[model samples]
Structure formats: C-alpha cells, structure tokens
Target: MSDSFGFGQRFTPDEMASIRKSLRDEARFGSEFIGRLKRVAKRIPFAEDLLAAWVCTRDPSTPRRVKLTLLAALGYFVLPLDAIPDVMPLLGFTDDAAVIAAALAAVAGSITQQHRDKAKEMLADL
Candidate 1:
C-alpha cells in the first residue's frame, strides 16, 4: 500500500486518509456516477467474463505497465477516489467517468477484439 507512483514520490498515510475522507464525502454524488458506470459496464457485451479474464491474467505474462494501468483504472472503478467529489450532485461523477474512460482507452489495445466482441454481445442484452 506504500508503493510509489513515480520517481521519488510516495503517497503518505495522511494523504491516503484525506483521499478516503474525500471519497466518503463524495459518495452521495456517486449515485449518478455509479449509474453511468453501470451503463458502461452494460455496454461491454461480456463484461463479467472479460473482467475475470483480465483478473486471471495477473501473472508475469502481463506487462508491468499494462498491469499497473489496469490496476489504476480498476481502482478508479472500485475505489472512491475521484478528482470531482461525488457529493456535488449531477456533475459530480463527470470527472470520474472521464478519468475511467481515459484509463480504459489507454489500455484498449491490450484488450483483445474477442473480448470486445463478447462485451458487445453482453451489452446488447441490456
């Protein structure tokens, strides 16, 4: 939990605590954001399976940078940390969505077309 993001930089416990507090404060704003995430999740045809596959591939075979980026993205999804506090009402989750979308876009090349196809298939059901 004390890992650094880059050269000579680290997130202290205090910073992490502040982040957690911010996330908690933003939770109310997260409802709409969560809804948007659900919609995006729905769009992925085989989202559950693809997510499982992505998780299963957490071995050395996966590129370190890719893994890190994915972890960051997944964290954005599951973690409460956000640039825009989710407590701000309608616009609160906008930034969160943008961040997650950017993260997903960055790693899109790593995801196989088959995964996309499957996700699309699953999304159609929603």
Candidate 2:
C-alpha cells in the first residue's frame, strides 16, 4: 500500500523516499519552512492544515511512510512553481490546499491530537 497522492496522482516508493529526503534536508537547512507558513497563512487557505502537516514531520512517532507522503505535500507548498502560480488573487493557494488535504488524508491515522495541538500553538503565534 503506497501512500502517495497529489491531485489524484500517485508516486512510486523511490520517488516518495526522495521527496522525504528533500523535505528533511530543507527543514534541517533552516526554519524558513515555518516562516513561510506564517508569512502566507493569512492568504493561504487551509494554512492550519499545512501547519499541522509540518508539525507531524517533527514528531518522533510519525511513521516514515506517512512522513514521506506529508513531506511531498510540503514540498509542493514550498515550490514556487506548481500546478498553479501563487500570485493570482483568491486562487494562488488552492493547489497547495488540495495537496495538504490529500497528504493529511493519506496519513490521518498518524496525525495525532498532539500534532493538531502543536499546529494550533504555531498558528496562534503567527
């Protein structure tokens, strides 16, 4: 059972692993991920969900496979070029929101209450 999703698309295990690695490396590189979320939350609908997905990436208990799925989603969020450009009014973040929703659905079981709480905490600060 592969946990890959993107606009009804799917990914192979190898691809999933690569995405996860990239996400991990990005996080290690800096805290810009959070900063980006904070900076865009007001304009990005489903921003809370994105924040929750991010928190899941940091938790020790989140399964590797689940993390991979979420990482890909986050990767999409951070990508400047995507299915839709992030500059159009009222439409910029829709693709990002969909990816986040798909990622959350793929790993809903692993997204615990603790993750949501932490996301809320972050959102409060934003």
User: 1-126, model 2: which lDDT tens digit per residue?
Assistant: 333422344567788676856666664523666767878888766877888888898888877767767878888887768888888888888888888887788778788888889988989898
Candidate 1 on 15-122: residue-level lDDT in tens? Answer: 556445534544453454345446666443334533533442344555555555554444465555577765676666576556556656655556666655654554
Per-prediction tally of clashes = 8, 0
* TM-score against truth, every candidate: 0.44, 0.82
Assess candidate 1 and give its TM-score to the true structure.
0.44
Clashes of 1: 8
Best by lDDT: 2
- Clash pairs detected, candidate 2: none
Where does candidate 1 have its weakest 10-residue lDDT segment?
1-10
| Best-performing candidate as measured by TM-score | 2
